[model samples]
Structures are given as C-alpha cells and as structure tokens.
Target: MFDWLYVLMKKLVENVFGLSLDTGIGDSVHFFFYDSVKIIILLGFMIFTISYIRSYFSPEKTKEYISKFNGISKNVMASFLGIVTPFCSCSSVPLFIGFVEGGIPLGVTFSFLITSPIVNEAAFAILWASFGWKIAVLYVVMGVVLGVVGGIIIDKRKLEKYVEEYVYEMQMNRPDIEELTFKDRINFAKSNTLEIIGRVWKYVLVGIAIGAAIHGWAPEAALTKYAGPGNPLAVLAATIIAVPLYSNALGTIPIAEALLMKGVGLGTAMAFMMATTALSFPEMVLLRKVIKPKLIANFVAITAIGIVFIGYMFNGIAHLVI
Candidate 1:
C-alpha cells in the first residue's frame, strides 16, 4: 500500500535532488520522508477510528463495567480496555485515581495503567505498518499479558497499604454523562485526532530523524556486537537505559525499527521501547500523588521484570515470527 510513497521519496532524492540512492545520505533522506509521511497518515487514521470507538466508553462507564467483574477477570478486562484508550503514562494517572476512588482493586488499576501507554491503537497501527501484522499482534498480546500478570502479583502481595489513606476515604461524585449524536461522535473523533496528532507529531519527526540517521550512518557491526542477540545482557541494558528517558510508544517505534535494521536483537529493541513508554520517571512522579513510594517502587520493579522477560522471549522466538 505504501510502496508508492517509497518510490516517490526515492525519485525526489535521486532525481530532483540529484542524490544517488546508492549513497548513505540519499538513503537516509528517503527513509525520513517515507517513514514520517507513512506514520503520520497511519497515526491520524487510527487515532480517529479509535477515538470514535472510545467515545462510547467514558471513564464513568468503564469503572461501572469493570466493577461488575472480580479477580483475574477484572485485570484481564482492564488490560484489554487499556488497549483502546490512548492515554500516555502521565495522562493515565487521572483515570488511575478515578479507578481507585471507584473501589477498583489497586492491582486491577495497575493493569490498566501498565497497558494503556504501552499498547494502544496508535502503537498497534504503527507496528502493523512498520513490522507487519505478526509482530504487531505479538506486541499487543505481550502487553496485555504483562498487565494482567503485574496486577496479579500486586494483588497477591496485598500491597493496598501502600496506597495513600485519603484515596480510600474520599467519596467520588458521579457526574451525569451527556448523550452524543452521530455528528457529535464524529466531531469528537475529529477533534481528538487533531489533538493527539498535534501532541505527538514532533516526537514522530524526531524519532524518524534519529531512525534515519541510524539507518544511514550507524555501524551494523557495533550494534550487533553490543546489543545483538548474542549479548545476554542486551535486554537488561536496554530496559535500564530506557527508564529515565520517556517517550510514547509511537515515538519509540521508529527507533525500534531503526535498531532492528541495524541488527539489534528483537528483544533488546522491544525492551527499550516498553521501558521507555511504561516505566518513565515523570509517570512515577505523577503516580506518587496518589500512591506511596513503596507501591511505586513495586510497580516499577514488577513491570520492568515482566518487560525484560517478554524481551527475552521475543528474542528467543524472533526467527519464527519475523
């Protein structure tokens, strides 16, 4: 479907600018244009479609629905719900608090928190576009599993004491939800599409620019030597390095693509992406407003371990999928 975009970029680089496709700079420029345009178009369309579908599931409605479920089923439902809601880590905090106030288990709330930023529609669309459906499906499945497992661990540990006392005492006032017509839903989707694209466009450009540079100039030998499948610690190093630096999955996907092209191990690149999106420092800071420090630490530690495990698993089976 996007072959024309690649051909057009090739012509623009080689014919219009007189740069040969054989040169590194020419290939880098083509990559930047092709990926940037392709991601933007895919992002816009997916965000609109998702926002439209999301219009039906308000936070109030979601809380009510999840409240009906119990045990592992609640965690599973919450994680699946997280996939449809396009909240980044920090943005997910407010809904996290709402879920807490609504009497949802801390573990189930954590499930939603973990999955929302890591595996939304935007990430799925970009992954499918860049790496084919097999990898995209794998990513989504892994993300959900991580969420569910993390939630179960937290629940099993009975870590509710780590949550702030005020959270339990505060009463939540349920506001009336306004009914929307078809046109209203369309407008909401349009506005949401524009809002999200406006927010993440710069990240997309910067990510693609970095990816382009790596695509054009980075040494394959160095990448393979350090972060390749042969390096047992590659996934661990990737995950550790990613925690302090934050970006949404959309931004990180391009870098992941670049790393893959440079022969970086599949597990290492994915671990980096997951840690960047899900274990960000700013997110921890925001989460601190509601939860105590120990719970925060537990959340980080559990989620990080799950991400690393998934990374290794992916690396082990990469050939079968790729």
Candidate 2:
C-alpha cells in the first residue's frame, strides 16, 4: 500500500509539479537534469530519513554521548557521522544552527558542518562511479580528517564563547522539532525532498550552466598556460578563483573533465574542484546568517587552508606520475 502511495504520489508530483519525468540519464547525470533529479531524490530521502531518526531518538540524547569525552572515539564517530548526514555545503549553516539549538556538542556539530559540504552524496556517488574507487576513498578520508580536526581544535579553543548572543536566547526557548515514527519518517522524507531540493536548485542549475559552458567553449590554451603541468602556483590560483564562485560536485566535474582534456594539471583542477564544492559564494551567504563575521572569517580561513593543503597534495601526487 505504501509502495502504491509512493508511486501514485510521484505520478501526481510529475503531473502537477511539472518536474521532468524523463527516466534515467544512464550514468552521465552530472550533465543532465534527469540524472540529477534522480540523484537529488535519493539524497533527499536519505537526509530526511536520517533527520527523522536522529530527530526522534537522539535529538536530545546526543548531547550526552558527545559531551562525555573529547578523544579519538568521539572525533572518529563525529567524522563518520559527517559522512552519513549527507547535506550540501549550502545547508551547512542552517544545519549547524539546528544542531547547536538541539544541544549537540560544539565539536560534533562542527564535524558534520565540515564534512557535509566538502563531501556529500552527490560528490561521492558521481566521483566513485565516474572516476574510480581509489579517488572516492581518498576523497572520503581527506574530508573526514578535515572535519574531525577542524571540529576538535575549534572546541579546544573554546569558540563556544563566540557564538552569537541572539542564538543563545533562541536556544533557551527552543521548541520541539522532535522525533517521528515509521509513518512520520515517510512524511518527513517527502517534505525534506521538496525543501532540500528547493533550497539548492538554483545552485544546481548554475552548476549545470557553468559546466555546459565549459564543455562547449572553454579554451585549451588558457587551461594549459596557467593551470597546466609544471605550474606549481596553479593549485593556489584555482583555490583563490574557486572560493568566490560556487560549483557543487555536479557542476564542477564537467569543467574538470574539460580541463583534464586540455592538458591542465589534474592537481590544479582538483584544487579548484574542492574549492568550488567546499567553499562557494552561495554557501557563504547562507553561513553569514548563522555565524558572525568573525566566526565566519575564522571558519573560512581554516577550511581554505585545508583545501590548499589538499590541493598541493594532489599536485604532488600528480608529479609522481605526470
């Protein structure tokens, strides 16, 4: 019956909502809406389901689990939890706000914040399927390390003192955004499917637009000159250029692929890819609402430094072969 409801509701959504119902992009989905939508749908469901479970059970209890210690076990769990939360960089500030309000420890919440944007479902699925398992595994490892270390240091520094006073007052009187059962989880998934997609469709479209432009018109000579082999500074240049612009995984891969064909250094392209994924303009706009300018500045600096290191690592790795 629920399966029937799911299908029927999907049909209704297709007819009334006017989303493209064209089934399947047959693997090159980073370039097509049909494939992208499917990815979004699967991701939306996962987010909602996880949110529902966490909301219902640990929304309150997680504080205890985290606050008991500040060691490897906690940080490691924090890192892996980052993987499962599956939110986009755009969603980080809001998710951060929500988690803090729900009484989670600062370090744990920061772990989720760092990892979600740097690595996400869209990134993992597309990279693993397109690139290979090795790249995907390395991506996951790097993201987790960044998230865990960033979270722990921020915690040790007592940055909680820097949290906005307004947020404090709000957390004082927080209302119930609580747990749900099986049926409720379904409703939660459907609602989140729309909400998550709605917040991000603009970026997704922008990514696709940027990708298509790169695919069609990018100059081979331009790619080779500054961002090519023997250019150690290319990684840094890509990181600087990418931070101001936003391109989630879906959009950046096409451009990266184009650059790869143009003799651009893979390491430089990788830096740009990480920057666009983890530090986009849209993400900053959203974050500004939650974090004060000081905190945002700090967060940006820390994350950018991590990306730069990763960028150099990529360049070093490439030097080994190319």
Candidate 3:
C-alpha cells in the first residue's frame, strides 16, 4: 500500500514540478511528501476514533472502574487506563490529587501517570505510520509493562508517606456534565483531531526535515561508530541524554527513525524516545508541585530502570526488526 502511494506521489511530483525522483534531493522530497501524507491521514483518523471512544469513559468512570481492582490487577488496569485516558501532564496533577483524595492507591495513580504520557496516541499513530504494526505493538506493550512494573514497585515501597500534604488537602470538584449525544461525540472528535493536528504538525515537519537531512546527507559510518549496539554505553547514553530535552513522542519518532537509518541501535533509539516522552525534567518539576522530592526521585528511578531494560532488550533482538 505504501509503495503504491509512494509511486503515485513520485509520478505526481514529476508531472507537476518536472522533478526526477532519481536524484538525492528529489528522493528526499519524495520521502517527505509520502511520509507526511501517510502520517497525517493516519493521525487524524486515529485521534478522532480514540476521542469518540473516550467520550464514553470520563475520568470519573475511569476512577470508578480502576478502584474495583486489587493487587497487581489494579496496577495493570491503571496502566492500560492511562494509555486510553485523555489528559496531559498539567491536567494529570489535579486528577492525581483527586485520585489520592478519593482513595485510589498512590501506586496505582502513579501507574496511570507513567503510562499516560509515555504511550500517547499521537506517538502511537506516528509509530504505526512510520514503522509498521509490529513496532507499534512493541512500543505499546513495553509502555504498559513499564507502567505496571513501576506502579507495583512503588506500591511495595509504601511511598504514600512521601506524598505531599497539599495533595491530600487539594480538592477536585466533580462537576455534573450533561451526557453527550451521538452528534456531540462526533463534533468533539472532530475538534480534538483538528486541535492535535494544529499543535503537532509543525513539530512533525521539523522532525521529518531533520530526518531527511540525515537520511540524504549524513555520514552513516560516523553515526554507527558511536551509537551502534557494539558500543557498550550507547543505549544508556541515549536514555540519559534524552531526559532533559523537551519533546513529544510524535515529534521524536521521526528523529528515531532517522537514527535507525543511520545505524543507531534500535534499543538506543527507543530508549531515547521513552526518556524524552516519559520523564523530562520539566515534567518532574511540574509533578513536584504535588509529590514530595522523595516520591519524585522514586518515580524517576523506577521509570528509568524500566526504560533502560526496554532499550537493552530491543538492542539485543534488533535483528528481528531492523
């Protein structure tokens, strides 16, 4: 399907602009157009569909459903819920407070928090569009597993003591929202799709532009020499390096794809992506408004461990995908 689309795009570019797809610049242009179209279409459809489904599962409903589970099941459910639930880091702070005050386990809430940003829908769409179903599935599975493990680890540590007193004091009002009709749901989905597209399209273009430059002009040997699997610290270095940079997973997917093309280890690229999306320094600072320093440290430590594990595991089995 992609090849057919690429050929069609190539012919269109050639006929309309008199540009041959055989040259380096032409090839890059072809790549840019084909990937952009493919990703945009996929992203719009995915966000709209997910947003529609999400209308039926409000935060209140999510909390109610999650509160029913116990033991590991609770963590697992929380992790999965995080992926499907719609909330950014800022919104999550209030929700976190509400959950803790409402008797949701601190660990389970943490599970949701960890997975929510890490396995974002935009990132999922970009991964599926750029890589394929296999890589996309792998990313989601790893993200959910990390959330479950991280939550369980926090639960066992009894980290509730580290939660700030203000979190308990902060009250979230559950406003009575009218139930949405089918038309309302469709409109909501449409608005959400447009909003997401407007926000991320620039980032996508920037990322893909960088990717095209690297793919068309950069030196493969130089990249491989430092970032390849043979380099013992490559994955660790990438993860650590990515922690401070602020970027969404969707924006970074193109960069990761470029890195893979340049012979960077799959594990290294994935670790970098996970680190950027899951635990940036700014996100930690925002979280600090609700969680104590000790709890924040624990969150970073456990999440880092899981991300590193994912990195090494992918690098070790990279042949299967790369």
True lDDT of residue 272, candidate 2: 75
State the lDDT at 134 in candidate 2. 68
Please give me the total number of clashing residue pairs in predicted model 1.
0
Candidate 1 deviation (Cα RMSD): 1.9
Candidate 1 lDDT tens digits, 1-322: 8989889889899889898877899889888988998988888888899899988877677788889998899999999888776576556667877898888999999998898888866777777767777998999899999999999999999999988888788787777778999999999999998987898888878888999898999999999999988898999998998887775556777888988989888888888878877887888888898888999999999999999999999999988988
> Against the hidden reference, what TM-scores do the models get?
0.93, 0.65, 0.94
Where is the poorest 10-residue window by lDDT in model 1? Answer: 84-93
The TM-score that candidate 3 achieves is 0.94
Q: Under the 3 Å rule for N, CA and C atoms, how many clashes does model 2 have?
A: 1
**Model 2 residue 82 lDDT?**
64
Which stretches in model 3 have alpha-carbon errors above 4 Å?
A: 13-22, 169-174
Candidate whose lDDT is highest: 1
The TM-score of candidate 2 is: 0.65
- lDDT string, candidate 3, 161-265, tens digits: 888887777777778889999999999889999999999999898888877667667788999999988897998898888887656556777877877888988
Error of 3 at 155 (Å): 1.0
Using TM-score as the measure, name the better of candidate 2 and candidate 3. Answer: 3
Q: Model 1, residue 197: what's the lDDT?
A: 85
